[model samples]
Target chain A: MMEITEGSHAVAEAVRLCRPQVVSAYPITPQTHIVEALADFVANGKLDAEYITVENELSALSACVGASAAGSRTYSATTSQGLLLMTEVVFNAAGMRLPIVMSIANRAVGAPLSIWNDMQDSISLRDAGWLQFYAEDNQEATDLHFLAYKVAESKEIQLPVFVCFDGFILSHTYEPIDMLLQEQVDQYLPKFDPAEKLDAKDPISFGMYATPEYYLEFRYEMDQAQKRAKDVIAKAGKEFGTMFGRDYSALTVGYLLDDAETVIVAMGSVCGTVKDAIDEMRAAGKKVGLLKIRVFRPFPSEEIAKALSKVKRVAVLDKNISLGAKGGATAIEVRDAMYGSMIPVKGYVLGLGGRDIRKKDIKEIVSLCENGIGDQFYGLRKELI
Target chain B: MTLAVGCRARPGKSRDNKTGSWRVFKPSFDHEKCSKCGMCQTLCPEGCVHEDAEGFFDPDFTYCKGCGICATECPKEAIAMNQEEK
Candidate 1:
């Protein structure tokens, strides 16, 4: 049944349906509402699970790691600083091959104390050995959790997953979500029976120090599992579509790209605005399209390159910077993907520290692409500079 | 030899890791000088040390990486981190 719910609560409703055994989270803006909703489910007996509220994000994720290793389906939620703090233990969960699902309310990391939405938080941990998924809207965000656990627990891919949704925008916005019924979810995501788990009766150790001789193999094995997950994600999406009505089979979605002359590439809630802009531009016969990336890690380089093969120019937008690096992380990755393809891929930085990227911004960027405008910042106030 | 398909090991009793081979200096307990304080047993980082029937602390070296803290922390100087014969 369809019901109007806040995005965070919608995700909580989805999580409740899946019946996580343990949930540990530390409170931060945007993500606060998510963990709060889960805590309420545990508090009101709506969800039969252990709701653990920890002092900090490190311990919060650490608790999830311990519980997950102990053969329990576990969850944790965090934002920018919280995600940063959880980094050390977070990597352990991946190396230990625990299938813990984390809901990342994508927010800007701060020295200036930002609470607004951006991709920097999770993107910074791109190599932390977790399967990463970005949602264009609340519905996809909610659905990715199910897919996250599915792929995470797959025998081939026993890795943690980060289902990232834009902070504030998708995390707080109310939208109509077809929250899956408990029975339907149970049919899709069966009770987690991890192949490897810690037992007092049959003791085992995980995340042991791999000697130099054995370390590279462990890392290679993890990469192989991620490669396997690319297929597993598609399988899970297909299965999810068959059971539900939404098709998430593609790793990347191209809006108006089949006959597009110019394109703007983006992710997260900004894609929604970009889609609206593409429609407007198409009405004016501008021959513009938007290439929205759903999975940034294990990057869909070939898919992205193929999507824009016919397009003349591409503008890659990033809500986060790579600090002192060349361009945004997505831009660098996209350029790497487009290597040898010879497409004029330009990188544009925007929405850092939660600055809004309206539909007009997308239209202007496409216009800029058509006008042969090269890589530069979009939506920057020159007066402020 | 073929490694496992994934990073996953056999999932129990990794007694074959042969971590004791990593011990450049192995801890050897001297029963004659032992006070039976069980300090070696408590100080062994591997927790592989155990009291024998005579209450002398002896370590099961199979699982021990052997940092030699047991020898270093022994109050009665009853333990020695001796170089391996090899």
Candidate 2:
């Protein structure tokens, strides 16, 4: 069934169809509605699952971790501080190779406390050994949940997955989405059965320590597992599109980059705004294009290099900052991915701490991509300040 | 770095095998009571304990050097120590 719905509601519907055995979380704004809806499903008997409302985000992840080890599909969602608080468990889940799916409502971390959109919280944990996927709109957000389960539960790639959507942008924005039927989702994602689990009848070791001589090998094995996910992700995504009518580009999805002289690179909700600008600029006969990076970790370096191989200039726009560093974090990675290539890569840091990023601002970015300095910063008004 | 396996010392000048060089001491378990839940195995900083085919657990005394970590961390309390004569 298709319906015009808020992005959060769409996400809730997608999660419901996935049929998680355990849904546990702590309530934080922007991410609260997601868990609240799941709670409703559990309360109303719409979904048969254990709904664990913990005191804090840490325990939320902890409870899910416990449940997952006990051999059940588990889920949780959080924003900013709640995400940060769950950092330990986040790494643990990945290290343990549990196929737990998390929805990170992209928000800024706080000492001053701002409940707004930014990719800082999720971006900071890029090296924590989880596969990361960013959604550009409500449709993508809804679809990524299904893909997340498939990718995470694959026998070759048994790692946790994070499906990130911007806080209050996609979370609060309304859009028309074609919801997948429960049977369709079932066809796409089979029940999760971990190779090893905490079975009392089995009585085996879980998370045993390795000595210095052996610890590095375990970490290396996990790295190898992530690399295997690349192929599994592509196959699963393509199959989902064939069965459920949603073809999510598993790695990097490009738009109109062929023979393009200037390109703007971006992710998340901002990419939708950039695409509108690209269409307008292309109609004016300007050789401008946009590349939306769907997967941020296990970064599709080779795919990205192949996509941007022909481009003469690239302006990477990031919604998060690395703080006192050279450029936007994603831009740095994109540039490195194109390191040996001859493309002139530039970066622009924009929309931090939930700043408004209008289409005009993205157009300005395209202009900068055309005839301005490399590594520019957008959404800054120095004179007004 | 040499692997700890071939380690030996001169007679009478031989180091006490009990505590090795460590000041603190921790107990190791016999293969009898270990259920091999791996609670202590994962939590140990020294990573001294090992498991066998029957799910029994053992700690390497050469590397263990008595941290007491595995003793307290064990969920089943399967380990105890014999203190050296004062």
Candidate 3:
């Protein structure tokens, strides 16, 4: 039987089920509940794991990488500033092929430092060799932990996984999250055994400096591994569906995409609101759709292009900026994918730095797509013309 | 031996050794053919291709990825892709 609980508590329970040998994380608003609940589980002896209270997010990921290297399943959590601080180690975890699953409460990285929901923090590190999954709700967030672990630990693609959820919107808000039971989780995720470990039995050098002659090959191999992960993610999601009765799309999620002429492409918690908007729009006989990007790092180019190719127009809503570029980071990737395909996809920069993302704003974005103008900014406060 | 579709046959290892095996010439200039166009010099991303003291051009294949961009983009067709044995 699955328990219906708050999103943070649900993710915490799921992590506990994964039975990580070591758990480490720093405290940050909106992402605090996940760590706090894990700490509670540790204190109560419900989880048999080493819970390390780290000084910073860098240490948090570093501890996870160390534990994973030592042949153990590890877990961690963080938000905006915390995620930003851990960026270097995040890349290291992926490059080193450590299968650590981290729950990132997606927040706006800022000058003002607001602890609210947005995709900026994680979006900034899209090329950092991690398998990223943006959860639309508490239930998806809970289930993604299991799926992320399976895919990341797969022999074909051993990389760290970032299961992203909106900061305040999904992390703080209470929702009916149906989390799997302990026995089921155990049945689904077998004990993690690293093929190559930092063990005394086989003393091998790790992260050694490579010269120009060998460095490009190593990076290319890592890129090739990530490409391999695309298939692994799909296979894992399929196995998960059979075991737990939930199907999570590996790369992209399509809502009313079939027979629709225009679509709004989004990610993270904003997708939930976008879906709601799409439902209402369809009810009024509008042929609009939504495509939520679940995996950003791998770019999901072919999948995104295939999904949006049939549509005449698309509005790519991005929460992160490339700064000095014409399009947002993800928007540029999507546009590049659709470049020769003849699909008129426009990019919109919106909801940056914890700004409120209302459903009406998404509706306006779709309406703008209908207008056929190129790229435009949405919800930007203007003083005077 | 039958090679795979895209796989090229490896030349003699000893012969390659004698002639700088798998070395990429990357086109050092023939000044007689060179117009001092600086086409190859300008297009190289690695900055390996450059003008010499005599205004003739040369490419330092030691640092090149062999991306062939310079060879592809030289307007004068001065840069030719040459292969040396390893």
Query: Which candidate should be chosen as best, given lDDT against the real structure?
Result: 1
Error of 1 at A34 (Å): 1.1
| Candidate 2 local lDDT, A1-385, one digit each (tens) | 8899988889998999999999999999999889889999999999999998788999999998888878899998888999899999998888878889999999987866889888999998998889999999999999999999998888777788999999999998899999988888888888888767777676644454444554576688778888888888889889988887777745888888887888888889988888888888788888888888998877888888888988888889888888788788889999999998877788988888888888788778777767757685787889997
Shift in Å, residue A27, candidate 1: 1.1
lDDT assessment of candidate 1: 0.86
Candidate 2 iRMS, in Å? Answer: 13.7
Q: Model 2: DockQ against the native? A: 0.04
Q: What's the TM-score of each model vs. the native? A: 0.85, 0.83, 0.81
lDDT accuracy of residue A95 in candidate 1: 88
Model 2 fnat? Answer: 0.00
| Chain A TM-score, cand. 3 | 0.96
lDDT against true structure, model 2 = 0.83
TM-score of chain A of each: 0.98, 0.97, 0.96
- Model 1, range A213-303, lDDT digits (tens) per residue? 5779888988888888888888899999999988777789988888888888888999989888888888888888888899876688888
Tens-digit lDDT string for candidate 2 (B27-73) = 75855666678876787677777787777777776657676777777
Candidate 1 error regions (>4 Å):
B1-86
Better of 1 and 3 by TM-score: 1
